[model samples]
Target: MSKVRAFTILEMLINLTIMSIIMGLIYFAYASFVKQVINYQVSIDEQNELTTSYVQLRTDFFNAERIVKSYKGFKVIPYNNKEIEYKITDKYLIRRQVHMLDTLSINKLTISSDFNIITKEDLITKMIVETTLFDEPIEFVIAKDYAPNLKLKL
Candidate 1:
């Protein structure tokens, strides 16, 4: 009688072991890819938020009737009487105005200014916002040239 060919028990176990190892490797690779994608998405969202916040801040600065430096950030007094205060920290910047608030998350934040007056007391002609995103440095400078007579109010 001819013996029917079939996989031996040892061969079957070996096949299963190889398959398990391959599957484990594939799972690990997939997990890593997913983690990287998630991180990339988070960074993109943060970048968008930072960009939008900067645009709004620049608009406020341009239209501000008066700007005063506060404890950490600055305050913008618009002509319509809606006073906006920006509070900055290492991690976030918060813009508060009347009934609304906007928060921007940042890795690092630094604010500086160019003074037009020699006294350097609230005579900020240009305001600079410096930050870093994904190891790339970014800066936003907003300048408002005030009339000589209006220097004190600004």
Candidate 2:
């Protein structure tokens, strides 16, 4: 009677090496996929942050009666008893709401919105903001319309 052949040691060793190579390739592919997912998440977060900043800025400006151009920056006294100020300093844009007690960093506002007359109350304000997120540059321009009764009658 003929005996069934068993796998030789050399054949088993070759099978193990092939399996190891396949496993290594699979691991490399998985690592690449994980890295791409992480990068995508980071970009989404940056986009959300930029959107929130612009929304807050629009809300503040829309609710403001008038805006004053000052040496520090643009100042506004809202009818809701809150004083808001916007400033550009050291490559950062800052917004401070005195009554709300909130401070936030917004992107940079370009010089186009700046007024030549420092002492005038500007009813119509234009804002040109340039900012960077995750090494990407973005810019936006906003034109704010103020209420006609902004100047209180003394």
lDDT of each: 0.77, 0.69
Q: Model 1: per-residue lDDT, tens digit, 1-154?
A: 9999999999999999999999999999999999999999999987898888889988888888767676788888877878899888877788998889898766565455444365455644566666777778787777766655676533
Q: How accurate is candidate 1 locally (lDDT)?
A: 0.77
Off by over 4 Å in 2: 1-5, 98-108, 111-124, 133-136, 150-154
The most accurate candidate by lDDT is: 1
Name the weakest run of 10 consecutive residues (lDDT summed) in model 2. 145-154
Give the clashing residue pairs of candidate 2, or none: none
lDDT value, residue 10 of candidate 1: 100
Candidate 2 lDDT: 0.69
In model 1, where do residues sit more than 4 Å from their true spots? 1-5, 89-92, 104-123, 147-154
